[model samples]
Target: MLKIKKKFGIDELVNLTSILAILFLAAAVVLPHVRAFRYFALIPWLRGIGLGGLFVFLILQAWIHRKKVSELFGHRRARSGANSALQIVLFLGLLVVLNSIAAGHRGRLDLTSGRDFSLAEQTKKIVKNLKTDVLVTSYFKETNPSSMRARELWKEYSYLSPRLKYRQVDPDKDRARAIQAGVKRYGVSVIEAEGRKVEIEGTSEGEFTGGIIKATRGEQKVVLFLEGHGEASPNSQDQENGGGLSTAKEAIEKQNYRVEPLSLIAHPQVPASASLLVVAGPKKALLKEEVSAIASFVERGGKVLLLLSPQVKTGLEQWLKSYGITPDDNLVLDYKQHYFVDASAPLINRYPFHSITQNLPDSFFPAARSLSADRKMPEGVSAAPLLETSDSSWGETNLLSRNLEYNEGQDKKGPLTLAYAVDVEKKEKRQKTRLVLFGNARFASDGAFTAVGNGDLFLASLNWLAEDEDLIAIPPKPPGPQPLVFSNGQMMQVFYAVMSLPAFLLFFGGLVWWKRRRS
Candidate 1:
């Protein structure tokens, strides 16, 4: 051992120990950033052990060969110190230049679990193909956290294209500008392009991208709602009792749609410029002339949406029968307690392969009925189901009973349809008339519109009725909160390694020295 030590001098040993110390220190600094370290419980302990071993090696090398190290580097210590200081100054200057260059050019590494800070694919597709400049104005208060997040989000869009730019205006400071721009609340985003503008109150990637699509469209679609039959009123602000559809109207308007209340009693026929007509939850039966006008509209290849509540005697049942759709007069009850909030609200997650219901989230309909559609079709008419209840659900026949149970012959079995879409071919015209029927109108009421995915479902149905299936239902993704988790055993391991190792080392060394002195 002495001969080997002579061959490999103290200088070589010191160099080797210094390299090991640097490697261990680098591992200790870099391991926490790794994704695998979060799942692997032993990585932190290993890092701590490496750091402790490096500290021990450094102290032992310094103490054993203190004279040799002093002779090697201390003779010209002033010159060495001067060179090190100059090198550190040069390194700092280089780092500053690099930082300035990096600041001017935008480059982001979205390390979040959901990539929440990055732009979505749908947003990139719209921004990258911009032919005109899009000016996005944000109305926010500088003191709010939403203002900071909105600024961060708009930067992602701006980085994608030069034609896209954003400006932030504090609503409190600039009250006139806010009123002029029609800013209703904080964090409202107004997107303008080609002399058109859209105001969106949501900050999701999908909402902003949808606003861009609406502002840049060539033409707007019009959706007319029928009134005067004791149906749900659009002008009413009362949310409960299913008296208002204001939230549904706002959702449709966000897609560049023009929504207006129409009455067939005043007009002889449906308006020629109408793209889609809606009959929402009529409480009274339609008169003969009004029914004839609606029939004429459908006969001439028009699109229509009908929402009927349970047990309402809307006299158009026979006409719907001709199209092979039957709106049942029973209540839908689901025994799946986990899927519904109560027995009245049936949750639906299953859907057919249709453009309207594709990729839709789970929807909950409170006090809804069911529809019936057979495999047999009418001549040149095609019909399909949109939403259906689970196998644990059934239609209750006796509404008067306190404890509702399915009767063998009277009540219907599971998997009942709640909505249906029907398409009819016109013999003389090139266009097809489309009809969508939902058994529940309360789903779109202002009070229950945002219950679950009910808002997206409502918008998607409107898009299908207006023949704008391309923009069915694109919703935003929000980031979820992440919590810190550690087990008691893991915490104990960490404490022993970080707090106890050095104390143990000192005690062991002291015991050895005391024994040697006694000998």
Candidate 2:
């Protein structure tokens, strides 16, 4: 008893206090929300006491072991050990800084073959450019696949814009909130903005994003497709026959635009509320009255989209010339840019930076005609090329030739313009008139609308004409099958790997401490 009392002196007492202080500090951090600690209000005091006690104990221990401590560090190997300790501290600090930054920016890469977890381009644009606060509340059952899925999507949406706020609640536990949000069942997402609310039932990209659009964009604009001259029908659902513009219409409507067919023979004039006038490959020629009415529509500061084909006349060529746009009678042939063995189906990868073609990918126009703008434009009218052929393509005037090569003088040189955008400002009326002329109407037809960038081009052009360029980007794609399942063997392997690693690290650390103490 006397020997033990002698060994457990003030030095041992101080050492025990220091260790207790460290354990208390760790408990304060790890058990921050413990009811007992909070009731006693020891969290803040615990940290301060731990720090003070550690400082005092360190000072006393250094004084008691002053000679031994000095001798320990005097050796070159001991100094190297001190340097290694400093490097470890610095590395830990760097890791803390990185984790802090990562917490601020919640981002992750979605590595899936179908990009199943990624937000659509159009959705990204809308959220990033949010003008007002949007709150998206998700109602999904806990442990449901949809709950996890919506959370992953909300993480991305929240990262995009600070204005977009997301909240997830278990439908069963939060029944009161769910009922208030009109979420009768799970998988409903309520989006509220500007005193308006929209509910989305499922994870459909179209519905989810379309709700945001409606909440942001209040009033919808009308897009009128001219029909009397046998224009391509926007209501056509026949993808097999390539008869309808159904795909094109669906894309346009997704941007919150209303599409309807207009006939000059029935209505005799464009509606005053018509936001855009589309003439999609008018097979028959327009009557003189119809042509006059179309001109009047353009003069009244309305937008017009003309999709013409080679050698096809809508009787608007002379009228188009007045606006510095002429649909050339020659066929456009791109030997360099066209698809395999089909020189006429030119794959246009190049684009000028206009709102219509900004970020637009490669688009193909099948059996397209060439268009030209006069070197000097009409007064107050500006012309810009939206789509063009490569320098290897030319305008072949001899449409009768089946087997063809470029003719030097008889045919126009390569790099002919296939599409032109004309902007006319009527200063007297304080109104602006926009025109988007494409030499090929087939590009916007049903079968071809799904081609790469083809649908984006059509939708973008309409948005530009309507002066709603905010709604332009690649539209969202429907979610695909996403299943993450593991077998028993894989689960066991993962479990053991996760469990064994920390145990191994802790064991290794203890062994190192024991060896150092023994030394």
Q: lDDT of each model, Cα atoms only?
A: 0.76, 0.80
TM-score to true structure, per model: 0.63, 0.74
Per-residue error (Å), model 2, residue 377: 1.3
Q: Write down the TM-score for model 2.
A: 0.74
Model 1: lDDT of residue 515 = 100
lDDT of 1 at 444: 84
> Which ranges in model 2 have alpha carbons more than 4 Å from their true place?
1-92, 106-121, 204-207, 428-431, 477-519
Q: Which stretches of candidate 1 lie over 4 Å from their true place?
A: 1-133, 137-147, 158-190, 197-211, 337-341, 427-431, 476-519
lDDT of 1 by residue, 1-519 (tens): 455435677667767776776776576567544433432234344445555555567677868877876666655775598579769967975775465445445588989854566775446756777778788999989998888888887878876776777888998999999999977788799989899988887566757776887888758777889998888876775576987888788667766788899997877588878888899899999877888888888887778899989888898888888888889988898766222236667878888878888767667777888998756877778888899888878888799987788787899888889999898884655547899999998888887676656777777778787876666654444334423322233355677889898999999999999999999
TM-score of model 1 vs. true structure: 0.63
Clashes of each: 0, 0
Q: Could you tell me how far off, in angstroms, the CA of residue 39 lies in candidate 1 after the best superposition?
A: 41
Clashing pairs in 1: none
